[model samples]
Target chain A: MQKDSFRVRAADLLDIPADIKGGLLHIEITGKREVFIENHKGILELSENEVTLNAGKETVRVLGQRLRVLAMNNNEIRLSGIIESVGFVREGSSCSQL
Target chain B: MQSAVNFVRGSVLLEVKSSYPERFFNLCARHGIEFWDMTNDGLGVFRIRMTVKNFKRIRPVARKAMCRVHIVKRCGLPFFLNRFRKRAALISGCAVFCIIAWIFTSFVWVIDIDGYAELDTARLLNELSKQGLRVGTYAPSVEMENLKNNILIDMPELSYISVNINGSHAHVTARKRTLPPEILPSELPCDIISDKDGIIHDITVKSGTPEVVRGETVTRGQILASGYVTGRAGTTITTHADAEIRARVWRKKSARMPKKYSEKVYTGREKDLYTILLFDNRIKLYINSGISYTKCDKIIKRTDLRLFGRYRLPISLERATCREYEISKASVSDETAYDSLSKGLMSSLELPEDAEVINADFITSSDEVFAYATLTAESIEPIGTKREILRNG
Candidate 1:
C-alpha cells in the first residue's frame, strides 16, 4: 500500500495521469447519468439504489436512483442511473475519498 | 441501426440465473464474452444481449459461476434463411426473373427519332435501319460514337445529330438543313394571258388591272389582266400580276371496250408456310412440295412477344397464307361492252367534280364498242401564262 501511494504521488508530481500507471483505478462519471470504473477487480454488490465495485485495494460505491449495470467485464464495470454521489473506501483505512 | 446489424449478424437475448449474477457477468467480461443492455430482474435473474458467437463462448464461464443460461430469443439472417429455404420455386423464380430482366435490358427494343423536320421520316428511318439501329438491335453491338459519325457522313442535310440509348430505347435526334429563299418570276411586272380558248366563267384579280370581263370570249395569248395599274391620282403604277381565271371549257373523251375479257376465279388450292424471324433473318420451319400456282396472292403476318406491354423481343413468328386463282375467259355481250365503254369514257376524261355532262353517244363496231362524251367543266386551273410587258423608252 505504501509503495502504491508512493507511485501515485510520483505520477502526480510528474504531471502524468494516474490511470496510465497501470496500478490505479480509473473512474469516469458523466454528469449524473453514468459511472464507468476501469481496472477493477469485480462487482462486489449490486442493488437498485447503489452499486459497489472492487478496484484492487479500494472499494468504490456509487449512490444513485435506479442504478443498473449497463455492461461489465473483468476489469471494468459501467453503472447507469441518476447518480447522486460517489465514495471510495481504502482497504483497512477510515479515510474516504470522493 | 446497430441493433439491426447485430440482428443480421445473429444475436441472442439471454437470461442468466444465479445467486450472484454479477459474478457471472464479471466472468463473461474476463473471458472477453462481450454483452450489453444488462438488466437485473428480481430474484437473481439477469437479462442481457450478446452476439451468437459470444453467447456460445460463455457456456463454460457460466458453469464456473454456478449459473444457468437460457436463450430468450434468436434473430438475424441465418435464422431467417433457414425458413426461406423451404420455398424452392419462389426462390428460383426470383433468380430466373432477375436473369431475364438483365438479358432483356442489353437489347434495344424501341427506336425513337426526335427533332426531325423537312426530311422524309421514312427515308431517315430507312437509312438508320441499314445501320442496324432499328428495333430489336443489340445495344452492346451499337457503337454510339461511330454511329453518329456515320449518320453525319451519310446525311449531309443533317446539321446536328446525336444517338442516345437509354434502358431499352434508342433516341436519335437530328436537325435538317434550311434552304435559301426562292426568287419567283411573279416578282417582275408581267401580264396574265389566256392559255385556252373559252368563255370566261369567273375572274379574280389580286394585284393587276382587269382587261377582260366575265362572259367574254377569249382566245389563246389574249391578255386577261395587266400589271400596269392607273391609281386614283391618274398615275400609272407597275405591279406583279396575279389573277385566277375560271372558264367554261369543252372536252371530248372516248373509250373502246373489248367484247372478250378474262377474269380470275378462285381454284380452292392453297398453301401455308410458317417461319421464324429473328431480327432481320428469317428461318423457314415448314416446306411445301411443288407449289406451282399460276395466279396467287400471298399474305404474311408477323407477331412479336412483348414483355410487360412495352418491351418487344427480337424473335417473331411469321405465317404466310397463299391462295391460288385460275384465269377463265369470258365473252362480254355488246350491251355489256356499251355500258362499260360509257363508264370508262367518263372516268378517262378526269373532268372536274362539278362538271356538267352535256351529251353521251355510243357506237358499236365488230368485237369492240366506242363511246364519246362531251363535257362542259368549270375549270379553276392556273391557265394564265406570263407575258413580259414591252417597255417603250
Candidate 2:
C-alpha cells in the first residue's frame, strides 16, 4: 500500500499521465468498428468472439462478433469488427469488475 | 499508404501456422522488424504481409515461436523484373522506340498551309524553305519574325503571313493581295458614245461640244458630245473629250421561270467515310459502298492531333460525309414568279445611285416571260467621240 501511494505521488510529481507512468496499455475505439491497443505485451487468447491481450499487469479481454486482427506489431495492434465490450482483469481479481 | 510503399520496395505475404501466432508478432516487434495487415484464420494459422528486407529476419522469430512459416505470395517491381529478365530483345526495342520518338519530335515533319486558295502552294513552300521554315528542319532554328519579313519582301502577292510550329508539324497561313481596278490614261484621242438607246434629258460638257439636247432621241453609238472645239477664226482645237449626259433609257430583260421546275432537294440521308492520313498518303478505314444517291454533296473534315496545345502531329484523321439529294419537280403561281423575277432583275442591274425606275412592263408567255423597264438617270459620263482628222473632214 505504501509503495502504491509512493508511485501515485511520484506520478503526480513527474507530471506523467496514469496510463504512461504505469506503462498501461492504451485502447482507442472508433465508433465500435475498430479498436487500437498500444503497449500490449501479447495475445493470451484470440477468437472470433473474444480476444484477450496481456497489457502490462492486467489482462484486456475484448468481446465482439467476427472480430478480425487487422494489423499488429510490437507497439500496437489494430482490431476491426463489431466490438461489443472491453473488460480489464487484474491478477487475482475477478474479471466481472471491469 | 504503408502498403503502397512496401509494394514498391517489394514485399511478401506469409502464412504462419501455430497455436500462438501473436508470439511471433511480439518477437518481430522486439527485433524492430515491422509487419502489418495481420489476419487470423481461426484455425491456428495467421496471414501477415511483411517487406522483403524483414522476411528473413522473421524466420528465427517464427522458429522460436514454433510456428511454421510459408510464403503465400510475392509482389512488386523485384518480382516483375525477375519474371521478364529473359526478354532482352523486347526491352531493347522499347528503348529504341522511345529514343526515336523523342528525336523525331524535335524536327518539323509536316508542313500544312491553310487559307491559301489563290496562292500557289509550291511557290509558297519554296519560299518558306529558303527562309528555313520547311519539313525535316529543326523547329527551334526557324526565326518566325525574320522569316515573315523576308517572305513578305520576296512575295508581294501575299498580304499577310503567319508561321506556327506545333510539335512535329508546321502550319503556315497567308492572305492574297487584292489589286485595284485598271484605269486607262486619257492621253490618246478617244470617243464617248452612247452605250444604249435613250432620250437625252441633260448634258454637261467640260471640254467638248454638246451634240444632243433634252427630249431628243439617241440610238446606240450616237455621239452626245463632240471632242472638236472650234475656236475663233475657224482654227479647231482637238481636245480629249469630256462630257456628262443623263438620259431616260429603256431596257428589256427576261428570265424563263417555268410553272413547274425540277430541283435538287436534300433528302437528309448521308453516308460517312473515314480515312487515316499518314504524311501525304491516305488509307481508307471504313466506307459505305452501297449508297445510290442521284445527287449528293460531300463535306470533308480533317483533324490532326496537337500536343501540349502548341505542337501539331503529322498524323491526321479524315471524315467525309456525303449528303444525298434527289431531283423533284415543283410548281409555283404567276405572282411568285413575278416577285422572284423582280428580285433577280434588281440584283443583275448596274444602275446608278440617283437613277429612278419609271415603269416595269411584264409580258408572261406559256413557258417564258419578259420584263421591259424604263429608267431615268442623272449620270456624269463622257459621251463624246474623237476621230483623227485626215487633213480634210
Q: Whose TM-score is greatest here?
A: 2
Tens digit per residue, CA lDDT, model 2, A1-98? 31455676888899878776665568888988999999988777878888888887678988899887887777788888899988897567856523
Q: For residues B302-390, what per-residue lDDT tens digits would candidate 2 score against the true structure?
A: 99876777566777899889999988977877777767776776566666676766665656444443323322233332233444333
- Tell me which residue pairs clash in candidate 1: none
Off by over 4 Å in 2: A1-24, A94-98, B1-9, B111-131, B139-166, B169-393
- Please give, for every candidate in the order listed, the TM-score of chain B alone compared with the true chain B: 0.59, 0.54
The residue-by-residue lDDT of candidate 1 on B37-89, one tens digit each, is 87776577878888888987987998899999999988788778778799999
Error of 2 at B90 (Å): 2.2
Best by lDDT: 1
Model 1's alpha-carbon lDDT is: 0.78
- The TM-score that candidate 1 achieves is 0.52
DockQ of each model vs. true complex: 0.43, 0.35
Residue pairs with clashing backbones, model 2:
B166-B311, B166-B312, B167-B311, B167-B312, B191-B385, B192-B383, B192-B384
